[model samples]
Target: MPELLPQIAEPTDASLAASGRRVVEIEARALEHLATRIDGGGSNRTFSAACQLILASRGRVVATGMGKSGHIARKIAATLASTGTPAFYVHPGEAGHGDLGMITDADVVLALSYSGESDEILTLLPVLKRQGNAVIAMTGRPQSTLARESDVHLDVSVPAEACPLDLAPTSSTTATLAMGDALAVALLEARGFTADDFARSHPAGSLGRRLLLHITDVMHAGDDVPRVGLGATLSEALVEMSRKRLGMTAVVDDEDKLIGLFTDGDLRRTLDDAALDVRTAMIADVMTRGPKTIAADQLAVEAARLMETHKISGLVVVDEAGRAVGALNIHDLLRARVV
Candidate 1:
């Protein structure tokens, strides 16, 4: 039978909060020390060299580690991949069992072992070397075998772990992860990666919708657009607005060029003038002239900004020739998740 462990008493709320604060402080100190190291000296030079090597490589970065470090490596790989640096994680132990075939000579290897003595990682060093792949090691100990054998060493050392017992991989892992983020951001800047590039990689999210969606993609075009001739009465404009359900109708000239816009707000103002009848009031007289308009090629986010700036809910989408080609409102932006 297995031995039963003793039950420990729960601590007070004050003690729990204090413990949490201490852990955070320790981790924060580790990051501060890491920042200082990267600001100058051998570590700074090595970091620059590592980034250059990755940038020069034609293939992806192969990140590998053992145990807890392996989890951090996986996250680092994901960050690198999403930020324009091609990278993926492979288990060191699994690599020995034929996963090594996944690596190519053109690729760069990034190995993580905090203590620098993970046998699983060290065992693969010789084969990687023989394959002519450049290796970058991230370790707490510079003198460790893995650090000594690699082409570049990233020092992720911390003063100590955040664990009360000083045995868990707390502060070291935090520092290592931060270092990984530094590498990714550096490469991102070197490659001139922009928000548009990031959005392309994340097409399923809200950022993608805001960046990739254009005014034409969200606007109602052709017969669906609410439009009325400049000679039309207020009643005809209202009928067009009701038929298209866009809350506004564009007033166009004889040549089908945009002249003005008649919106719900215009109707409210027209109703206040009891002398003018809806049946006879010309749309050109009651409509708002020189209203805010967006081009079909503009980003949908621009439409949102225009609406917010003018305190309006809809816009007329026009072509380069000043013709009404489409229509959209705040509701279309809401449905497209651009707002």
Candidate 2:
């Protein structure tokens, strides 16, 4: 057997838990401080001005930063892009190496530097200025070169870092990230970014399917819809249900207007209660009247909600005139990932 290592004393459980809690408390306090600084009634007009500048810009929002700030900058750019504002991230170090040409007069630059003195960011300022690129600086230091040179300076000052050593990015990065989210949300509302617009951006996500996929896209339409005449027998309705494999069938009047619905539950209830004879019973005598229906143009998620709320498995898709145009079941919602 290999030699056993001697056990060393670890910190007490209380000490570890307290340490984690202290870090979270400190970060939470930092976010609270940042929120007050950007309040409209506050002395700082930095955030509102920044939003106005970006809103008026005809070109993209170019984000640039170094090190930890660069990571936050990239996330901020992504949030901006997804929320409606067109934005992209470019590294400050890469700006001098032919990337400076990408900056145009119509573009606005958002540069992040916690210390407000990143040499790479500062050096490219004059060139960006010459190109008429409006600069917005997110920094902890308001008097530093980067902040002073920028057209707008939004302070993301944090009282302390979560790091015990005070060197690692912790609370400061969290504050910066929260500030970025605030800016993106503000712009999102200002631009009227709707769920449909968000769906188009995230076409592969579940939220996209819920917002963009309509009942018409997944409901069984045309002759494939499980439908039966109002005068049809219960046995004939069962045949239609079987042929459609929907476990339910819609009963319509002579005008093809939906009159009632019959499902497997009704069949079980009928057999148990001896309410009707399957061989000769009319469908109108046993079907549920005024059943919940979905419009073909409604979102598939709405159908899923109706089914879930009513504890149902299927619904008839009806037109504005109450005609049976399609049929949708819970399985269809599942297949479309709307469930």
Candidate 3:
């Protein structure tokens, strides 16, 4: 049997909510202060110089920190790596245990410490210097040992801690994180890093799908595409739509050029006229002439947008000369996560 749970005392709902709001308010102000510090509140030159150092480095930015600052350092490293700068997080605690071998002369070490005196991180400064690795310090105390010995120092000091006890690394950590983001984005812009460049690093993510997956990558081609000759009957078009399961068919002339589009919606309107026999009715008579078409190389997300804008469920992929070469339906975009 599972052990019985302990009955823990709970704080008042009102009190807990108030505390939550207070924490957010403190953290938000901390971030604001950081912005101010970067602009004119302190010395923005230090931050700019730090960015230049990393930008000029030929190797990865190796980040290390202790405690809560360590967690923030890991995230900062990831952001840098994903946004054009190559970086990795090295735990300061583990650095003394032979993990220091990961450091190379070409690498730049970015160390984080709220007090700027984390012994685990401070002890590595001599080794970093010995290996010719430049140090960039993210710290609340510029006068601290780590800051004084570093190549550049970023002041991430906050007005106060969000913790009621004023002991936990709360506001300072938040400030440090904001500073890290600022550094990464600054470098990204300096390097002309684009969303396409970011997408390449995250190919399996949604942004990558939106940017990298093209219409040709999802559209049906050749015989698999639903298409009908302009001279074909409505019934023949319906047969093509059924066989291809695209809910629509392109109407092409003898030159194999797309002249119009026919779909289930067109069939519904065609059925309204009881005087006409759909089996014998020509497709061009009821087709939508010069319907919206996308290029084979167009982004799948753009195709999805086109469908959304037109209240459409399918699209025909066309060649430069307006010849239909492929077709795709909403289902295809859905499967591709384009919708």
What does each candidate score in C-alpha RMSD?
Answer: 3.4, 3.7, 4.5
lDDT of 1 by residue, 1-339 (tens): 999999997899999999999999999999999997774765358889899899999999999999899999999999999999999999999999999999999999999999999999999999999999999999999999999999999999999999989998999999999999999999999999998798789888788898889999999999999999988988888889899998999999987888999899888988999998888778888999998899999889999999999999999988889999999999999999999
Report the lDDT of model 2 for residue 211: 87
What C-alpha lDDT values do all the predictions have?
Answer: 0.93, 0.93, 0.90
Each model's number of backbone clashes? 0, 0, 0
How would you encode candidate 3's per-residue C-alpha lDDT over 141-217 as one tens digit per residue?
A: 88999989999988899888999999998899888988999999999999999877987898887788988999999
TM-scores, one per candidate? 0.86, 0.91, 0.88
Rank the candidate models, highest lDDT first.
1, 2, 3
lDDT tens string, model 2, 28-107? 99999999889547476889999999999999999999999999999999999999999999998988998987877899
Candidate 3 is scored at a TM of: 0.88
Better of 2 and 3 by TM-score: 2
Give the least accurate 10-residue stretch of model 2, judged by summed lDDT: 37-46
